[model samples]
Target: MALASLIMLVPVVLVTSFLSGIFGMAGGLLLLWFLFLVAPASTAIAVHGIIQMVSNGSRAWLSRRYLDLKILAIVSLGLLLAMGCLFAVQYSPNKAIALMVIGLLPLLLWIPASWLTFDASRPSHAFACGLISGALTVMVGSAGPLIDLFFIRTKLDRRVVIATKATIQVVAHFTKVVFYINAALMLDAMGWTTVALCIPAAFLGAWLGKFVLDRMSDLQFRSWTRMIVTCIGFAYFVQGTSAVLSA
Candidate 1:
């Protein structure tokens, strides 16, 4: 990456980070999309995983007071189990179809929360969601919606929701990075330089997002999160459709 290109991405990273800080989910997806536009698929996935690991890590740290350790432990156990299974399975899914599924998933929010019988706060349920999310993230690039599903019905405050989700994603994305070890090797000094430059930008964005988060009522935060997530889903849907049609 040239210095000019790196400079160009600074603002993008800052903006996306701000969004991620505010929503705790959408920014990573959008950033993944941006990286996809500029890098190879394997490289994009690897870099996105790394950057998101940092982004979510910072967010989790910021809201450490609200970290849900129980959920993290349960979900991580399930995630590990799912990852172990992946090592034994040999499969190739249709990438286009997978993206479409990811894109359409957020629409589930339209269903009345009452209609969903699952208890998000339960350990069993959290583990189950993590198991599925771990697998889906390997298939698609990210599983923000699936992660959100695990907390949608919870009565926790917005900041806690963001913080807790951030911790879970840190695990998910770290797994993703290791899974694509070959891709990680593609990061030459320039590539890494770009990533390193973005780290602080990501952190700054999270800090600013904290300011925004502090002002919003929980209801407003939840509403905005759902709306933004739905839009991101549609963006992925369109990108997948275009890719399929072009191919």
Candidate 2:
């Protein structure tokens, strides 16, 4: 990457990390879009995974008191299973397909409460959530909306929701980095340095977001999260569709 492009990405990293720190959803989606503009599909996914792992890791640590270990363990088991399955198939997504999948993911947030009764508090549902969302993360580069489907209806407060989701995302993103390591290796020394610089920016953004998160009510958090994700999803879908048609 050019020096100019790398410089431009610093603020993008900070802002997206802040958003993810708050909602634990849209930031990664937005960051992935930005990355895709500058890198190949696989490389963008790998980079996004590395940055998000840091952002979510910081958020998870900040809210460690609210972490739910049991659910995380069960979900991780399902996630690992999904990863194994994908590895067996050696699945990889092209740019257009990846964009379309990510664009469509936000639709999950719009599903009516009565249509699908998924509660992440339940072991079975949580496992399913992990399996499905983990696969989506690896394949499409982001899965915030899909993960939200399992948690939105649960009785857990915003704190628990954010913390637990962040923790799970840390694991998911780490797996993504491992899966796409080869793509990331395409970057040269400067590219690697650029990525390293984004880490502290991500941590700073998450910390700042935590400050705001403490002041927001649960209702506001949930409502705003849905709205932001829906808007971003619509934009991505349009762009993806255009790309596919043009191709």
Candidate 3:
């Protein structure tokens, strides 16, 4: 990456991390879109994974008291199972497919409550959330909307929702980085350095976001999260569709 591009991205990292810190969803979607502009699909996913892992890790640490360990464990098992299945298939994604998948994910949030029955507090539902979200994360580089579907209908408060999701995302993004480690290794030194600089930016953004989160009501949080992610997803879908048609 050029120094100018790297320099420009630091603030993008900070802002996206801040958004994720607040909503625990939209930031990764936006960050991955920016990365896709700069790197190939595999490399972009790897780097996005690294940045998001740090961002969510910090958020999880900040909200550690609210995390549900049992849910995490069950969801992780499902994530592992999904990873194994993908590895067996030797699956990989091209840029258009990834963007289109990401574009379509936000619609998961739009599913009416009457039509949806998922509750992350249930072990069965949590496992399915992990399995589906994990596969989407690996293939498309973001699964915030899919994961949100399971939790949004639950009775858990906003704090628990954010903290628990952050914890799971830390694991999910780490898995993504490992899955694309070869692509990560292909980056030159400057590219690696650019990634390194984004780490602190991500942390700072997450840290700053917690303050705003504390002030927001539960209704405000959920409402804003859905609105923001939907808008971002629509833009990505259009861009992806245009690219596909041009090809």
Query: Could you tell me every candidate's TM-score relative to the true structure?
Result: 0.92, 0.98, 0.98
Question: Which pairs of residues clash in candidate 3, taking residues 3 or more apart in a chain or in different chains?
Answer: none
Return whichever of 1 and 3 wins on lDDT: 3
Q: Per-residue lDDT for 1-247 in model 2, tens only?
A: 5678888777999999999888887888889999887888889999999999999999999999999998899889888888889988999878887888888888888888988879989999999989998898888888889889889889998899999999999999988898899998898898889899999999999999998899999999888898999999888888888889999
Task: Show model 2 residue runs off by greater than 4 Å.
Answer: none
TM-score of model 1 (CA atoms): 0.92
> Of the pair 2 and 3, which is ahead by lDDT?
3
**lDDT of all the models against the reference?**
0.80, 0.89, 0.91
The alpha-carbon deviation from the true structure for residue 1 of candidate 2, after best TM-score superposition, in angstroms, is 3.4
True-structure RMSD for candidate 3: 0.9
- Report the lDDT tens digits of candidate 1 across residue range 46-77: 77888888888889999999998888888888
Q: Candidate 1 overall Cα lDDT vs. reference?
A: 0.80
Clashing pairs in 1: none
What would you estimate as the lDDT of candidate 2? 0.89
Put down candidate 3 lDDT per residue, 60-92, tens digits, no spaces.
Answer: 999999999999999998888887888889989
Question: How much lDDT does candidate 3 score?
Answer: 0.91
